[model samples]
Target: NSKINLAANELLFREGEAGQFAYLIERGRIAILRDSAGEYQLLSELGAGECLGEMALISHDPRMASAMALEDTTLTVITRDHLKERMARSDPLIRHLLQLTLKRYRQSLGQTFPDTSSTQDLDYLEDEQQAMQRMRTEHDLSHALDKQEFILHYQPIVRLADRITTGFEALLRWRRDDGQLVSPDLFIAVAEESQIIEKIGHWIIDEASQARTRLASAYNGKLSEDFYVSINLAARQFPDPELPGVVQEAIRRHGLLAQQLQMEVTESQILENREHAISVLHNLQSMGCRIALDDFGTGYSSLAYLNRLPVDALKIDKMFLDDMLSDQASRTIIAGMARLARDLQLSFIAEGAETEQQVEALSALGVEHVQGFFFGRPFALETKKEPA
Candidate 1:
């Protein structure tokens, strides 16, 4: 049985006081008050079914606001101890609701502006709000990221001249809790913004290397053991002083040869920090690891940096490969890039080659490697290899 009372006006808890009990309004109304300049200001109004003292109940901390009866209000009181005992045996749904309540409270505080402060306080509050939003995004992403939630999909790269499978790129896919497959573009940005890109990038390296090792083991008795796995590297992960050592450890753990794994770096990163990027590339190349400049022509002065960077390959951006037959400029660019790659003794890979015409154009351009939907969309690497 709960203690119920009908309280009148001036029946409120003092500011900075501790809360030992939570209250639920059963009748009339209640007002939540906060101290501003030594005066109480109404923060919110509560009616039937509305609960108060939640934060204090959860943290056992001092109450930041006071609850007072607006009129002759009937309230049911539940002691914090009782609430804790109930929470200890609460159902998952109830626990989730409490968590959501806490999240919403934090969000509200993040968005609220304090009126008693200067303009600087407003700017500070805005920054705090952004930080809080980022934290929430990270929390949600962390819940979504798990080994069981990730799946490896492979897309084949073909030799344009022979129209044969050269190798496959391991792509990450997530079949979300909602049973829908999430596109990389959707979650990749969130992961990057939350600083979780490093974890995801490392996971990709490990998964791709493991797949390559398994394939190698399977084809040990076969005539050809010439498949390669390319994994994209985030620019944020590059500056880590221990990155080279981490890559070496990953290779050893996965039983993969350093030459079999290619690290794909966006061309823009190379152009932005040429010196640092070159040093990193040199370190990787020293370890016998191959490096590919991804989205090659998309960057400014990309051709200029190509000579400076110790990259082994150039991945032609998909934008250039799209509508290759209809776009003569694109065809010319691809041809020039392919010729330059040949002259420089570098491998040229045309990405997103989706049509027969595109494949034919690339072959004619002497582009050796091509990857796109025309060859194969990304799929899980099962034990058996499907036809090229």
Candidate 2:
């Protein structure tokens, strides 16, 4: 019952496409051809019951030839998974030979063998495939980085007292080639797992520093602004010992005051390796780069670390603002946090403030800065320069 149907002269698959299975023609015929100087050269005519594309599953290579239906055709599909199950049940000597063949094949394909231990079970082959997939993803991301597909968006944080913009938070955006935007939540985790995030984090920091100069020049009205740009750092990115030196270099390269480049770290990010993170943060703080303890009151918000670390600001998580009006406890918690920020001499801003009433409430609670949709959505960074 595992049959696939194709209309007359239909393309079963094109050359260079990934193949997962072989096809046994149950009826009609198929033409196997290769592209030669822009025309398809017919290599063979496969009749009913002849197997096609069988070599693809064995080699894990792209289809070497294009396949088209000569007429209406039915195919019995034999999946790679079925073949893998049979291979798994084979003798150890057979499996060992297959491994050696795969190793040689990978070398021909310009790839080294994935890290497989000698004692691994037959499932190591599947793991090897996953390793290849991860490698491909990292390769694509590296190319995306070079192509400048990643961009920076800014959301202004307003000083509630005068309703003036003192600083902006830099948000990362990935615009795919198909014109769809990918959320950072989806891709950042992948980058972090592969350690590609370190490269990305350096890019963000450098961009943030350069942005400070342009913001001051183009929007030159805010001269003597002491404006700052906040950038979020991933937890895995902090362990690098050279991170502080790189940040210092960016500040100097952009002619930016170190205090103008703010690093935002979450409770979890710093908590991962508190001792190591704190040491690096200490070096950065001494260089005059400010740090913000971001998303306060979220998971693992420890006062112990908050007091211990050299943080200059506290960004209250948006969850409290969502129900502050209806819930007294939410209001109380916000008030307490604002008071704590004040007591610690730290700047405070409530995140996700969408309503005017919430802004009014926050203003009354003695919160100085607020950043959310009510003030401004994430604005696109314009590259326009003012006329001389």
Candidate 3:
């Protein structure tokens, strides 16, 4: 084995290079990349003790990817000639292991390739027909909304420093007729483009408020009266001048207090049309409701808008906190934001705190609240009492 050192950002291998050697990493990390339509796509990451270039060595073919060192790295290189020489002197079991590795590599390549052939062209036409049929299925989904195919789930946001459950965020999910659950990502965009977001947003407000009322009644003066429910507002629906009046009516119908409900708007939505969004936010706030800037620091002008808007809270974007343990810059930024929140008297929450390390870091940073899979996944409103 030959030892090689790579400097930070150095290219370890180029795509389509002849692979004569496989490598075992001894230090640092490498990112594997594939070229797609002339642009590089990050495929996977490899760290210490991980092997790379093995696919090419096993298949005796050109390298399928380009790899680059993320930091200074040390690697142990084993040439294909040496491996073949070892195989010649090894037992049948070693030869079988090498053959199995080649078979797996070919299987993986087959799974990654796109289907393109004369028969595949015909299959493509058939697939288009299937896609059109699926469009019809959307009509079923549209109709099912009236039948309650779409429902709201609540996930609690607890104050990490105090362990107090301050509020629940309402999340949407779809229960399809085939018993398959569809993610909101698949349908929410379609609904927004079709202008159905307004109806759905209103539905969420009514349902969540009613559920909050029921929970309060069940707890019967044992739980904090300030326990609130938060729902996301679609940007398109915000332009309606009647939104405050509509929400007020929903509050009256559910016998819920206005301050017990909050509205979360994404930073991108507010930054896109700051003047109009600020106006809408002010209107909502005037109606005795609280406003939160969701996914903060994720959009252009997010910090600028935060200073201008009358928002009560800032939910730090999850991506920033995800790498806090490994990235000093992320931790520094989050800690700085928490300090800014304290100075501004704005409540701060870190979303996507998935580990004990992340929780400890946020607590140390003085972030008031935390939410993520570490606490619990979103659950149906009736099931909220279950452990997080």
TM-score of candidate 2 relative to the true fold: 0.65
Q: Write the per-residue lDDT of candidate 2 for residues 1-388, one digit (tens) a residue.
A: 3889999899998987777789999999999998887999999999987999885555555676799999999999988776877766654344555666755765685644333434434465665665566666667677778877788888888898888878889998887767667778867866887678898999889888888876666552233388799999999888876688789899988898899989999888888888888888888889998888888889665586678898899998899799987888888899999999999999998999998999999888788899999988876667453343
**Which of the predicted structures, 1 or 2, would earn the higher TM-score when compared with the native?**
2
Give the per-residue lDDT digits (tens) of candidate 3, residues 1-388: 7899999889999987766788999999999998887998999999999999976544445677899999999999978676665655554334444545655665686533322222422533444454455455557666766977777777778787567777878888888877677888877765665557777777778788878866556432224558888888878777766677778988998788888999999877876677898988898888888898888888777365467897998888789887899998988899998899889999888898888888888888788888777776677645343232
Tell me, by TM-score, which candidate is best: 2
Stretches > 4 Å off in candidate 2:
1-137, 217-224, 383-388
Candidate numbers, best lDDT first, in rank order: 2, 3, 1
Show how many residue pairs clash in every candidate, following the order shown.
Answer: 0, 0, 0
lDDT (Cα, tens digit) per residue for candidate 1, span 1-388? 3756656675657656766778887887888898788898999999999888766565444566877887888777867677666755654334445545654675586533232222422533444454466566566667665635666787777776666665667777766767677777666766765568777777677778878756555432222256678887767667667678878888898777798888888877665566887898899899988898888878677355467788898888789887678888878889999999999999889999888877888899889898899887877656353343
All models: lDDT?
A: 0.73, 0.81, 0.77
TM, every model = 0.63, 0.65, 0.62
Best by lDDT: 2
